[model samples]
Target: MSEHKKGQPNKASPEKTHVENTSGTAQRARLLERLQAGPIDTFTAIRELNIVRPGARINELRGLGHKILTHRLTLTDDQGRTHQGMALYYLSTNAPAQVTA
Candidate 1:
């Protein structure tokens, strides 16, 4: 007579990996600090922050890609009238693309 037995390894038990917090208010603060440092142009700031889409927000401006739109600057006259003209380029480029899953 002979005995037969079977054993298997459990795949369900797994270890969890640690992940660091790379986003939030801290990152924004750092970005703002870099922007104010002096003689640093907008494009350089954008690149340093790795901000792909530079000015996607109202308070921001785009730099280094392609120009999609033009902004008209309005200057007020002594009589309280306004004049419109193209604003000088600080840096211009195409807008960055969004990421998707």
Candidate 2:
């Protein structure tokens, strides 16, 4: 059995020493909401949220036990030129159909 002195404070573990950000929590919640609503491409995230590293935020959501999937998209501009991009968001448990941009 461990004994504690009456006037002493217990030591905190290294795991308990980290502080979390309130803004990050809100951001993740919003990000998850957006993902659930529909596919959010990297461009959308950057444009809508003004996030420089949207993928990092998405990874944070993934670490919190959220099931997030990604699809590579190919888009064609008005000039009929094909361009490659990353679609950082689509939420679905079952396998999704092939996506084409």
Best by TM-score: 2
Residue pairs in clash, model 1: 65-93, 65-94, 66-93, 66-94
Q: Give the lDDT of residue 83 in candidate 1.
A: 65
Q: Tell me, by lDDT, which candidate is best.
A: 2
> For residue 52, what is the lDDT in candidate 2?
59
Number of backbone-clashing residue pairs for each candidate, in the order shown: 4, 0
Tens digits of per-residue lDDT for model 1, 1-101: 22335564222111211112123223333333433342223344344544433344213323323222434456554577766762212212321222111
Clashing pairs in 2: none
lDDT string, candidate 2, 12-53, tens digits = 332332223225555566567677677777767656655557
User: Please, what's the RMSD in Å of model 2?
Assistant: 10.6
What does the lDDT read for residue 24 in candidate 2?
58
Give the Å shift of residue 53 in candidate 1: 2.7
